[model samples]
Target chain A: MQAYRTLTRRELARYFLTSTGYIIIAAVTFLIGFSFVVLLLKLQQDSTLMPVTELFYITPFFWLILLLAPPVITMRLFALEKFSGTFETLMTTPVSDLQVVLAKFTAALIFYVVMWLPLLGCVLIVRHYTSDPAALDAGALGTTFLGIVLLGCLFISLGCCASALTRSQGVAAMLSLMLSVSLFLLSFLAKELPGTSSWQAQALGFFSLVEQMHDFARGIIDTRPMVLYLSLTAFFLFLTLRAVESRRWK
Target chain B: MRNGLMIQVANLTKRYAGHTAVSNISFTVERGEIVGLLGPNGAGKSTTMRILACFLPGTSGTVRIAGLDVFHQSDEVRRRIGYMPENNPLHLDMRVREYLKFRARLKGLSRKQSRGRGDIVMEQCGITDVSRRIIGQLSKGYRQRVGLADALVNEPELLILDEPTIGLDPNQIRSVRQLIKGLAGNHTVLISTHILPEAEMTCNRMVIMYEGRIMAAGTSENLQRLMSNTNQVIAEIAAPLADLNECWAQTAEIQQFDVSPAEGEYFRCALTARNGLDLRPIVYSLARERGWYLRELTLTRYSLEDIYVHVTRPDEEKEEGA
Candidate 1:
């Protein structure tokens, strides 16, 4: 437990000590601000029935931040250690492979949360100007942030697994970007294809992260999507553990 | 720790995809002994040390550290070992004190224990002044000391260092060697090096390896005596070449002799003894009996270099032959 804490602190500090951490925060903040301006202008023109919170998530800018941030945050977790040859020194210590994996995963997840904190600020800004009680629905905002955290867990674990598979940060980042983008696209298959059967649609809906986010933004917190995201997060973490242990045999 | 044995390996072998790195080699290190793993590059010295440190497992062998099985009780084995691998890899972004504290905590020390040990090790390695400095900005020598400090933070019972003096200048090498020697009798050290004089200077005993096999293992004097039987005696005498040859031929102890003209009247004579015998007295009596004017006579026993070359030569020839 102490090893895990120390390692996690070191991993988290690494993100801030280098310019990568601040660059990521800056990029995400800019994208959020841009998405807010565009969404607010569109809402004013169209007089849409969708709530403001729901409109916050479906923007291309929001998806762009979701697609890019985790990879950038996690690419250096294991890959940098290998490139620097600290992986051998770390593994030889009295810590288990599971601890190392969890430390890196948790640190990335925390950084992911910090990156999206600006979105909350933007939402509050909208509430302050409009002064409408309906715009500040507590339940919808809470679920939206919860959904974001769950999704962040899954994406960050995917990035962690990808990072463990290679020693080059560039390769790790590219591989993780490919994995997350493909997963993101898979969530939209049911809606994109016109010839899908009911069962196929149901199955795709069960796995659709976009639908989960929309439901959360509308104050609908179903246990099923929560279960799915949590299980998938666990699954990717398992893959990461196996990838970490694979170094011993090789 | 069985019978004071700090490390024991039996029939250890490591095979990569296409080649065998360490092949059925076995050796042991007792407690508090500073043993050197002397070998040329690619002699499996690092591989052997890695196995002892529990960083990797062998293909089919048993390695016990402090009487604990390396594969089964690896956590216990890891807690007892401080390993500085080849090139001394470190986190370049971390401060010196932070890196050491992290390492100490990772090695199972408590928070308070880690802080105290970190300070002690930093002071011991002479890096306290640079504790606040970022590791990336430090020089190579300071970075190397930081690696050593990380290894020593836990006060481990056995330290496995692979080529600790590699890539250092002479002054740095001497200091690092002195630091390692200072750790003797408190920690069992298994250091590997290819330099003959380094092994002779630091190690109380040496295990020479070649082509994944144990070429020889003993103290310097013991290895010299065990590996060599021929000694040489050089004499500068003013005598005819034929007379010198005849004198050496009459002495049974002289196995071979070489003669070359020195100055105008003196000839340099080198005689090889058959059984490591002292030929200085024999050469002096022979010259005196023959009324030959002798200027100098000295005997040269086998040095560590000669023994090392003698052991590693057959493999070189075999590789060339194949």
Candidate 2:
């Protein structure tokens, strides 16, 4: 437990101190803030009856920022260490490979959470401008945050696995970007394909993060998407651990 | 297992992809001893060190460090070793003190202990002045010192330094050697260096390796004594070539003599002498009797380089010479 905490602290320090970390977070925050305002104002002008926050949560623009943040944020995590040859030093320490990977994964996840915090300002903006006290659905907002957190875990874990696969940060970023984009596209296809009423469609829908987002935006407390995200997150995190341990053999 | 043995590697081999890097090799280092793994580049010194340090897995055989099996009990073995790998890789963005503190904590030191040990190692490696400086910003010498400090931060029983002074200047090399020599009583050091003289100066014993195999291992005196038969006496005599030939042939201790013709009326003569025989007195007497002008007459005692060359020298060279 102490080793885990020490590595987590060091990994967090690595992210916070690096310019790339700040740049990626700042860029994602800016994009989220812009998309939030644009989506809210566009919805307000088009239809005053629809909830602006709900529409903003389901926007493709916000999801684009979500998909890009992981690749940018996690590309430097393990790839930089491998490139600099510090991974060997870190591995030779008393800590196990699992601890190193978890620490890095947790750091990236924490930063991903921080990146999503800017979107919360949209709720604040709505609350500040609205004269109606009941306009903000607190339950829906909680579910939205939960959905975002779980999705971020899955994405960041995938990105970390990609980073662990190579020493080049550029290649790592490219791989994560490609992987997340493919996953997002495949899930969207599963949601958009024919036979939406069939059990097959429901099966495909389990992997559809778009469907998950829509349900989350509506304040639905379904456990299927959470299960899917959590399981895949574990799968990728295991791969990262395996990648860290592979250095000993090769 | 010997009572006080700190490191014992037997039949340790490492094969990467298709080719073997370290062939079946064995060696031991007693506690508080400084041993050098001397070899040329690609001679598997780093591979062997990595295996002992628990950084890489050995393909076969056993490595016991401080009584812990390296492959099976690696984490325990790692806790007992302070390994400074080749190139001294470090987190360039981290401050020197911060890196040391992190390493100390990773080695399971308490927070209070981490701070104290970090300072002690920084002081020991003489990097206290630059403790707050970023690792990448420091000069190569300072960065290497920081690596050394990181290794020592854990206060482990064994220290494995791979070419610690590979590219340092003369002053830096001397300081590192002084630091290593000072560590003899406290930490058993296994240093790997391709530089022969560095090994000669820093190591108490050496294991000379070539082509992924250990050729010989012993102290400088031991290796020389082992190769005492090949000891040569070289002389440059300013006499007639025939007179020099006759004098060298008449010397009883001389086993063989090779006289090469020179540009001037001097012969560059190298005579292989018998073991433990002093041929200089006879050569001096012969020079006096013939009224010869002797330019140079010296017994060639085998150095670490000579022993390394003789042990690693190919069979073809020996055959051609014979």
lDDT of 1 by residue, B1-322 (tens): 4348998999999988899989999888999999999988999999998888887889988999999999999999999999999999998888999999989989999999999999999999999999999999998888889999998888899999999999999999998999999999899999999998898999999999988899999999999787557778889999888888887888899899989999889999888889888888887887788899999898766788988998899978888999
DockQ, cand. 2: 0.73
Off by over 4 Å in 1: A192-194, A198-205, B1-3, B237-271, B275-293
Evaluate model 1: give its TM-score.
0.93
Per-prediction TM-score of chain B? Answer: 0.92, 0.91
Off by over 4 Å in 2: A196-203, B1-3, B241-266, B274-291, B315-322
Question: Model 1: per-residue lDDT, tens digit, A1-250?
Answer: 9999999998999989889999999999999999999878876786666677788877888779888999999999999998888999999999999999999999999989999999989988888888667867888889888988888998899899999999999999999999888877777897876666778777786778787788998888999988988998899999999999885688
Give lDDT tens digits, candidate 2, residues B49-157.
Answer: 8888898999999999988999889889989999998999998889999889989999889999999999898889999999999998998888888988888888989
Question: Distance (Å) between predicted and true CA of A74, model 2?
Answer: 1.2
Q: What is the DockQ of each candidate?
A: 0.69, 0.73
Q: lDDT, candidate 1, residue A74?
A: 92
Q: Please report the candidate that would top lDDT against the real structure.
A: 1
lDDT of 1 at B273: 89
Model 2 pairs whose backbones collide: none
